[model samples]
Target: MKTTKILLAGMTALLLASCGTHKTLMEQKPAPGDTPRPAADSTSHKLSYVQHISDKALYQKNVVSNLTFTVNNGRKDITVPGILRMRKDEVVRLQLLIPILRSEIGRIEFTKDYVLFIDRIHKQYVKAGYNDVAFLRDNGISFYTLQALFWNQLFIPRQQRVSEADMSQFSVDTHRLEVDGSAKIVLRDGKMTYKWVIPALWDQIAHTAVSYTSPTHGTSELSWFYEDFRPFGSKQFPASQSVEIHTPAIGQRPAKTLKASFELDGFSDAGDWEPFTTPSDKYKKVSVEEILGKLMNF
Candidate 1:
C-alpha cells in the first residue's frame, strides 16, 4: 500500500510539472519583430481606472508653467510663462514663443478639428486640418494635439492611435510605465508608426522618452522632464516642462535635432479660451505651394 501511495504522488508531481510548462509556454510573447499587422476590432477596449488616472491628472484647476527643449543639432530651447487653461471639448491654448518669427505666439487655439496659429508679432493666422498637421512636407504654423497626457477626454487615447494589432486591430502592448506615472503604448499603422506616452504620475511626468516614426520622415523622439508641481488655485500645476526632438536621416540630410523649452511662470485661467484674431494687414496667408517654394531658405 505504501509503495502504491508513493507511486501516485510521483505521478501527481509529473502532471503538475507538465501543466506548469504548458502555462509558461502560453505566457511567452514573441520578441518584437516585423509581424504583419492584423485587423482591429470595431469596438475599443474600455479603459480601466489606472488608465484614466493619467487623464485625470491632467485636468488641473490651476495654470501650468514649464520649460521645453527641442534638440536637433544641439539644443534649441524655448521658455514660455503662461497659464494652461482648458475647457473640456472646447479649446486648449498654449501661450508660447514662435521661434521662426522670433516673438510670442500669444495663443495657440485648437478646437475639435482645426488648429489655428495666431502670430503675436504680426497678428496673422495659419490654419491646418488636424490630420494634415502630420503631412509636414513644408514649414508653416500647424497645430498638433497635446491631449494624450489627460484622460477622460479622448474616446481612444492618443497613445493607442498606432495599431500594430493582433488578429484584431486593438491588440497592443504596454511600452513603459513612466516615472511621472503614465503608461506608454506602441502601435503601428502601415508605414506610419505612432507612440502615445501619457503622464503616469500625479501632476508630473519626469524623465520620460516617447517616440514616433514613419517610413518617409524616419523617427522622432520626444523626451519630457518635469520639475515642480505647485498648487495654482484648486489644482496642481507643472512649474516647468522640457521637450527634445530627434529626427533620423530625413532624405539625404543627416539626422536633424531640435530642442525647445517652455517655461511657465504666472498662470491665470481668467481670460476666455477664444481664438486669437490676427490683424488682417499684418501678414498674408501663404499657400502650401508658396511655402514649398522657399525650401532652399530652410
Candidate 2:
C-alpha cells in the first residue's frame, strides 16, 4: 500500500511537468563606495553588455538537423529519431519516426499564427490557428515562445514582434550559482530571467533556463541544456539538449511537467523547409472542438 501511494505521487509529478515553452544588454548599479562616473560613461557601460551578447547570438536564416528524441510524460517513455528544420521567426517543422519500425509516426509544423499536427499512424491531421487549440489558447501559448525555446534563442514575452525588444530592460550578472567548475550567467528583467551555466571562459552556455508568469498563464518555466556544441559557419550549436517545462498547478489539473532530451546526428542551416501538405482525401479532418474534447477527456 505504501509503495503504491509513492508511485502514484511520482507519476503525478511527471504528468504535471509536461508543457512547453533573451537578450542582453546590461547595466550594473555601482557600489556606493564607487566614484560617480560621467553620464556618457555610464551609458557606455550599459551598452557594452548588449554588445557582448549580440556577438554570441545565432540568429540563423534556417537550420536543419537530425536529432534523437527521448521523452517521458509520467506514464511512459518513448525514444524516436526525428528531423527538425527551423527558420527563425518564420516556421519550425519536426518529423518523428518509430525507432526500429522506421515508420513515420508524427509531424508538427508551427508558423507565426498557426499550428499543424499530423498523426500518420491514425491518418488524422489538424491544422488550425493557434487560438483554435483549447490548451494553447487557454494557457496563452504563442508560436514565438515555442520557437525561441526550440531555436536556442533568448526570448522576451508578449512582445508580438521581435523588434520591440528593449535593451534597457535587461541587466547582466556574472556571479551566481556554480557547479562542476561552471558558473551561471544571468540576464534579468522584472519577472523573467534568462540564465545560462557555462564554463570559466564564458564563451557559450551549457544550459539555459527561462521562467515567467502571466495573469492568464500563471507560472510557466522552461530550460534547455546544451553540450558538445557543434560548428556551423562562425557559430556553434549544442549537439545535445536537455529540455524541461513546468506549468503551475492550476484549476482542476495537477501541475504538469514535460521533459525531453535530444542529441544531434546531423545538422545544416540551408534548405527548402517546405511543410507537409495534407491530401484532401488522405486523412479524416476534425474540428478544433473535437481535438479539445479528446485531450480533455484523456
Candidate 3:
C-alpha cells in the first residue's frame, strides 16, 4: 500500500507539473552582430517560416513506445519502465509496470472528455473532467494542451488544434539562429506566453516553454525539452524528452518544482490496443482533491 501511494504520487506530480507557468528561461533576443539574416525581408518570409514549422506536426493516427519514466518531486526520485500510447484526438495513455516482472502497477489516461488514473496494485482510480482538476482548471490547460506537448507540435490555448489560419498568431524569430542555429517562435495569449525553439536545419521543435503570471497566485512555468531525433514516417521524432515545472506558492502551499524525464527505446505507429479503459466494479473511485491532497502531502 505504501509503495502504491508513492508511485501514484509520483505520477500525480508529473501530471500537475505539466501545466504551469514560468518566466522565460531562455533568452529570445539576438546577440550583438550575431543575428542570422531572414530568408527574405518580407511578410511572406515570416509566414513561410510559420507554415514550415506548423507542417512539422506528425500525421500518424497512432503511436506507441516503450519508455523509461523518471520523476523527481523534491523529496525522492522514482524511475520505472512504462509504455506510452497515443491516438490522435482520441486518447493518450501511459502504463507503468513493475520492473523485471513487468506487471502493471499504475496507469494514467487522458481522453477528450476526462482524465482517468488507475492504481492496479490497490484497485483504485480517479476519474475527473478537466475542470474538476484544480491545477488544470486554474492554469487554463486542457486535453489539447497536453496533446500538443506530447505530440511535439505548436498549439493555441483553448483550441482543439492549430490550423493554417492560426499559424499567423505565432511570430518566428531568426535572431537566435546565430546563437545556436535554432529559430525561436513565440505566441502570447492573455497572461500566458509560449515559446518554441526549433533547429534551423530542420522543422522539428526541439524545446517548448510556457509561462503564466497571475497577480494573485504569482508565476509558474513549464519547460519541455526534446532530443535524439529518429525517423518516423516522412518526418523525425524525438525519442528523448524531459519536462520541468516551477509553480508559485498558493495560499498555505509553498512554491514547488518538479521534473519528469522520459527516454524512449524507439517509436511505433501500431494501434492494436483499445484506446479507452473502463474500470471494473472491483476498483474504487476517488475524488480528484483526495488524490491531490495525498500527493501534495507526499
Best by TM-score: 3
Q: For residues 80-164, could you state the per-residue lDDT of candidate 3 as single tens digits?
A: 9989999999999999988899888999999988999998888899999988876677768888999989988989987998887
For model 1, residues 110-185, the per-residue Cα lDDT tens digits are 5556655444444445565555633331222122224432212222222332222332332233323313223444
Stretches of candidate 2 off by over 4 Å are: 1-43, 134-141, 158-165, 174-199, 214-218, 292-298
Give the Cα lDDT of each candidate. Answer: 0.38, 0.57, 0.80
lDDT of 2 by residue, 1-298 (tens): 3332222223222222222331221222222233211133354554454444434557567888886877756566656787778877778777776667666666667788776766666677767886765545544557776666665555555554334246555444423322233344455655566665444444555567776666765867777766666677777676777676776777787876666677786788775756445535878876656654454432
TM-score each candidate.
0.53, 0.71, 0.90
Candidate 2, lDDT over the whole model:
0.57
TM-score-best of 1 and 3: 3
- Point out the higher-scoring one by lDDT: 2 or 3: 3
